[model samples]
Target: MLYPATKVTLIAEHFLVERVCALIEACGGHGYTLTPVGGKGLHHLHATSDRATLVEGFDHQQVEVITTDRAKAERIAERALKELFTNHSGVVYLESIEVCRRERF
Candidate 1:
């Protein structure tokens, strides 16, 4: 069986992942996943390139949360945009998705 849900994607600096997770959990989110990523943004921060190794990866992280409620996901995104994006370098968006085990969410 499939259930509708919202998938929130947040790409932020590595240091801000914790705070992002906290915000999600505080707003009735069940869980999330974090994957370390590296790239150059508008700031041109090439933390990891051919010249650098895994140890040099510290510029970016991708955090994803799957929530059964769309409003909850948007709330988190809005909170992040208002509180974090103004000062911190990050982007947040939401995608519609379907989950197999609805109860797990």
Candidate 2:
């Protein structure tokens, strides 16, 4: 099996996960996967508390998108920054990756 694709990683305030996904879709990305995350930023801790004894819902989230086209990856990054970064804590990066099924991407 062979896989060929590019991966983009986006880290942002958890609250913006939905918005980021929307931007990715608008930019022609097929879809994205999200995972809850916790870390410290310049001014504050992203997650450090318990809500009613349960881990305070995720304060950060990491979003990843796999694409076959570089342009689509760039578009997704740009939109996520424009629509989310200014007012929230976030970072976006791109990396080359190999996937087994080119058609799936």
Candidate 3:
């Protein structure tokens, strides 16, 4: 069986995980997976510079969604950018993927 899949990767401040998931669902993605991340970026410094200890835990969260169609992935990216990108520290990217199972997506 051939599977159609698109990987949507979102890197944003930890607090927006739920909101980004909601945007993914709203754009017709069935589900997603999230992993905690720690990195440096322009926003990371400006926001956490004052808290020396807590800054170590101040990491971005990444959400990945596999969708069955390319359009769905594009929609998810667009909606996320509009709804959450502004005034937030993050980036969203989409990549084409091929898989063996059709139902999983």
Residue-pair clashes per prediction, in order, are 0, 4, 0
Cα lDDT of candidate 1 equals 0.80
Order the numbered candidates by TM-score, best leading.
1, 3, 2
Q: lDDT tens digits, residues 1-105, model 2?
A: 766678999987766788888888888888788888755551143433544433444567889999989888988888777877877778889999998777777
Please provide, for model 1 over 1-41, each residue's C-alpha lDDT reduced to its tens digit, 9 standing for 90 to 100.
99999999999887778888888888888998988776565
Show model 1 residue runs off by greater than 4 Å. 42-58
Which predicted model would earn the best TM-score?
A: 1
On a 0 to 1 TM-score scale, where does candidate 2 land against the true structure?
Answer: 0.79
Q: Global lDDT of each model? A: 0.80, 0.77, 0.80
Which stretch of 10 consecutive residues in model 2 shows the poorest summed lDDT? 42-51
Of candidate 1, the 10-residue stretch with the lowest lDDT total is 42-51
lDDT of 2: 0.77
On the 0 to 100 scale, the lDDT of residue 7 in model 3 is 94
Looking at candidate 3, the ten consecutive residues that score lowest on lDDT are 42-51
